[model samples]
Target: MATSDLHMQLIAYDYVNDRKTDGGSLAKMASLIRQAREEAAETGALCILLDNGDTFQGTPVSDFLAKHPGTHPHPMVDALNALRYDAVGLGNHDLDYGLDYLGRCLAQFQAPVLCANLKTSALPMIMPHTIFQREVQTASGETISLRLGVVSAMPQLTASWNRHQLAGNADVEPAMPSLVRAVQEVRNQGADVVVALAHMGIATIDEGEDAQNEIVAIAGIPGIDAVVGGHTHLRFPGPDHNGVQGVDSETGLIGRVPTVMPGNSGSDLGVIDLRLHRPENALHPQVVSCTVQLRSVDGETPEDTEIAAVSEMAHDKTRAYLARPVAQLSNPMHSYFALARPSHVPALLAAAKRKAISEAIAGTELERLPLLAAVATPATGGFDGPENFVSLPAGELKRRHVAGLLPYANQVWAVKATGARLSGWLERSALLFNVLRPGDGDQMLVDPQVPGFRYDAIYGLTYEIDPTRAPRFDAAGKAISNEVGRVSDIRWQGKLVDPDQEFLVAVTNHRAGGGGVFRPFDDAEIVVKKAAPLDQALIDYLKNPDCHDIRTAAPWRFTPKLGVSAILHTAPEALEHLGDIPSLHPEPYGTTPEGFARLRLHL
Candidate 1:
């Protein structure tokens, strides 16, 4: 019994967008971390807490920090510091404000922020990898030193998403090469095990240069013992999501690699346990066995009182900030029929962007081009659950309401686009809808593969979405439909859209920079490449005295599908406003497995 068995525990989570529910509270995670450490101690195993990044910039509190930067430490970093997180990888959103701000915010963290692929002049804040040396007690009551080599990296799209912010400040390398080299270096540094803290998603699809969702491929790289994933905000150990191959959603195993992806927003904790053995003939510490587990904060784990106390001030201020009145709505805002048409929320956003852009270029050369605002439904109940839908009563639009609606802190941007390119953009967005065959009975409206945020609805244009037709573009914006058009009868400013006509479309920086597979946007001529956050722009638009009782123009509609009706599962609250959208012919069909109320839309 001279050589004892070592139990290595790795826990991670991603896309914890912001602290709205108890499910994703860092305080709750703190309690879970403590419980995990206690359990590991009882079993004579080792426990190390690692974060998969996307820590800051999800909530109004984080947004406030970005808007008003100062010497005060970020609330998220404060919580992470108090929790004593061993290390954290960089998430793409971590650089939303800028590289310098990210560095400053990360400075307060007690744990090292690991990101190997990001090559930056600021080396003190970020590095390729790090070796954590710890002592763990064995079952035989013997303590031994263990070296955990951790290499963290993110998708190359960080360069694209944060292009304006990272243009010259930093650059990102291909994750695989950077990861491989780091693994070798850490191994050479007398590391017993190598773990990859990847801020990427588990994707079977080719990731191209971005490598944003390449966790499955990363597991196959040599010298890696385990992986903790993030970015896609998915929960593994559940089911093969979005057609990702080689992943056992039931076991959280991808190609024999033990992995964990705790659902985003502090909702769950991803735990990977590795049983290490030092065989007499073995050259290194071999992981003879591995197990993955997901721990959710579903009224089971209590919130850490201390951690909660530390963030209470931020929480209170954000709550008050969100409650402040900004404007008034003529009608209620909801996303139940956002996919079927340009619903109220998206319509309002587009109107705001249109107004903002029009004002900015009133006398400029760009004013001559037809103006359109491209906006997606933000409050769609996708990752945020059925209750995630935006349902603001016809009253004052509070800051909190905007936070709930806009969600992300994406800045407003305007791009010059040709009619053909705009058609392709809409076609790409149309991919979100499942092809509706004529006379087909109630079918799911949305394609689970396409996220709600990518479903762009261009304002200032009237078009019909023909469900029977194939999308002119795929989810990646490739012209795969081959003349079989999904978007048809497009009219700009009451005239048929000319394919060669030039126009300026308002979009978020996230969209303009190719955050989604919506291509051509990135190549489009930049007009207003930088502006205040979209939500802020909307706020400004609303607060202006000229705007009173705003209403959606309802410029888009679905081509009549006689017997083919689409059903969208949304929050039960949608039932109250079934009368508002007469076009959907909304009827409560039933409830989804996740308890979302299914409303059938007669297209």
Candidate 2:
């Protein structure tokens, strides 16, 4: 059995909404683990629990714990220990806090912690792989000792993403070479079954030279027996995947290898049943058959009492920390229709970033130039679900609300870029929408393939997007066309910006570090690199009355096409905020089967 991208959801609480979410948390999925283990025991099968990384470092609770250092046993470590995890693989986010902090937390793990690709002296305790030798009875009542060799590796971008934490102490090698060596090393150690715990998604998610998801490649390796994948926050062996060359999307088989990628935040429990048989003349057991299952978790699912009890104190403390007042809100804040129209949610974030960067570069030469901030709504009714939105009432704002607005633990960074780069950045983000034909009616507005977080809206400049034209950049931030593409009439300060004009842009380290697509910032010079994460910046910004009366209206719009209409899928609560975007001229169509409310926008 396996879990991936748990993202610090040891409990069932949603700090953003300040309520208990229905379909998340390791506590809820703990029941499924117990059930699977019981079934395996009843059938005389070996049930080993493994995690596919990104086990921590998300949510308000995670931030609270990371900030407040303590000598107490890490709640996640305790929970995983109590749950009896056989082995745990490393994900990119696991190193987000720092190598030192991560190493400290990892030291308490009762099971083997694995990360095959990373070469970090700071985290010397992390092993490349581990061999678990256990005895399982065959159907004929013959006792057989099996060596289950589990080799793990994550994306090479782990070091690139967390450079601040591991600049001098560590470096991550490319996945193929690192994993191949680790797999061979384990194979040489006399292993019966080789399971690749890959902390990555399938190749179809991202294509070309810098493809991040290497699940397909890992499955193609000769020594790998069964594979477990994650980091896409998606499910496998289901319709969520499209068939690739060696991947069987319908059956979750990657090159005849049974694979499973359970959904993130404990939404699903991935189970792979391997029927192994050893011949009398053979030295090792062979996997004769394999079955992969992704069990869904819902509110009705029973949570493990022990798991919840173990993390109760931390859960209660997280609630109190998020409840502390930051400031008062003039009105409710939400990002339900951030894609369909300009909204205040992202505008508020942009304003805070601008303030932080402005102060950080006070006397520096970069501060003398025009400053801008690029930010996007993290919750835009995408893979995180429709309910994954920021919804705060018109009252005192709290830390929890800020967490909903900016969920990631990213520090703000300042970059110096020319107008050309800025324009290219916006053009790259414009690809989030599908080109709408003039004569078409009820066409889909946003491209579901593009991540909403990558749809950044620059606050220092105003521009209009013409999606009727082909996007200059592809979803991978690669240039597919030479045309200016989509973004047009960009004005920095009531005037059109020259291509060579320079500006100071405030952005997250993840963006500056090229976490996602739109990597034009490579040539941009770094001006300021602050150690503070975004949540802390926003909290400080809100506490100050100077930044409180900031602009709420966004400065961008879609190029209107007569006789053309598009369907926008957003949260159902968007119905109440129709007045928030009178420009969209939206009409309620209905709700999608996926639970997102559909709105018909007449362009």
Candidate 3:
């Protein structure tokens, strides 16, 4: 048997929420990491642990770190350091709490933070690329030295998506060229095998700079032996959650280069094994073949005792903070009808944001403009799973419940938009659905590629979505077709919305700052901007001891189409409410491949 010259194991994980429980707790992942290292040791293979960023924020625990910063190490940094991560990359969310805070928090990380595309002068801690020299025991019982190079890059859109946080501090340049340059630079440093830790998604279709979904293109770059991808919060070695064109849901390979994304919230760990081969007289080794796999921290796994013990104090504090009662839900709160119709969750959020905007613009010249609030549930089983839907019963609500409702700490902004621009916004949002053929069989209602969070539900305006008509705009908010128009009968205060009339649209800085492909939002005049997150306003509203029942009125629905029916993919738990929503006329229709149940809606 020919003895293998180099056996290397690479472990990559991303989107850890500093969760100490539920689906993904770094404490639970510690055991899996230890197990992988043990297996690699037994096989005499070198092991490297790399985090693909988005590690600092997600749950209330991480929220605590960002909201209340101190000299102490962030719980996430503590956990990662305890696990001894080799390196990590920066994700857009990592910059959510301002550049200074991000820098301070990352400074405590034992692992080197790398970001090649981020243009900055203040933070010297970030490296473009890094090289590691290691000694590996070959299968033939011979010890040989190996050189491994790792480079990291985040989406160029980080500049826009995190505009509130990165303003006047740093800018993220285009990722593709910058990443390619970093790869070449690392190779020039005498590195044998190269890896790209890409904090971007793998979308088959391109949507320009804001799309920033460049993992597929990154994988095709030469000298990049392997890739660890993030930002999309998707799971690899599984069916593509979104039907992104070029992605192979099963293998996660782009043109033969092996890549893996471990899914978000520390749910799973991405494992890539590379075999290095070199001629006996060669100066460096090259990758021969690579195998990729994802290990999920599912129900069967137990948390590492030592890690749990280390993080127990913080975990207890977070739980206590999250459990504080804020308000009472007179009835159950669910997002099953978030896109299909108005739900109380977003209805309450829009009401609070509308009030906040109203207060912010009370004396301004723009105060007279009619105000409308746009809200969307960030989670809809897209990446958070089927059970990710909100379903708090009639009882006291807590800080955690409110956090679950909105999730991200997105700031609220009131944008001055003309009715025409508002129409375009609604048209762009309608792209979330597929066109319903007049006489066709049951078809999927939503566009798999568009996330549920991107589907905006405008409050203070009533509209009907005509599925038989085609969408007027594409995902990038560009007008794609004239024959198909999904948005129709748009009305304000029981009257038609004038195309030229101006209005104040209550939106998040994420949308107003051009986080999505929504147009006009980038250039729209900002009449009101809140320094605090939208969730804060909600928490205050809920905390009011005199808070009443959350009022949810159905102001929008699908236009009646006699012969067409649609399939709504939702949490299986929503089946119990089939008879409650009269507008949708929903009926259970078995389960989808993603474990979500399908509901047949009679239009």
Number of the top-ranking candidate, with lDDT as the measure: 2
Output the TM-score of candidate 3. Answer: 0.91
> Clash number for model 2?
0
lDDT of 2: 0.84
Error of 1 at 423 (Å): 0.9
The TM-score obtained by model 2 is 0.96
Candidate 1 stretches greater than 4 Å from native: 1-22, 138-142, 204-211, 240-243, 481-483, 520-524, 545-552
lDDT of 3 at 475: 61
The candidate 3 region of ten consecutive residues with least summed lDDT is: 1-10
lDDT-best of 2 and 3:
2
Model 1: what TM-score?
A: 0.92
Q: Rank the candidates by lDDT, best first.
A: 2, 1, 3
The estimated TM-scores of all candidates read 0.92, 0.96, 0.91
Candidate 3, residues 1-603, lDDT tens digits: the string is 000000000111111222333466565567778989999988999999988877766666667667777777666677677878888788888777778888887788887889999988777899999998989987788998888889999888778778767778888888888988999998898998888998876775557556777877898898998888867766765775346655666666777787887776656778989888887898778777778888877656777776666555555666677777788776777887676766777778877887778777777787778988888765576655686687767897777777677667789888888888878888888888888776565788787777888888888899998867778876666677545577889999899999999898888988887666676355438767773478887876665522342464555777765567788889888888876677667878889776898888877
Candidate 1 lDDT over 304-333, as tens digits, reads 888777776666666566667889876566
Model 3 ranges off by over 4 Å: 1-22, 241-252, 438-441, 543-552, 592-595
Q: Which candidate has the top score in TM-score?
A: 2
Per-residue CA lDDT of model 2 for 134-159, tens digit only, reads: 98898889887889899999888766
Q: For each candidate in the order shown, give its overall lDDT on alpha carbons.
A: 0.75, 0.84, 0.74
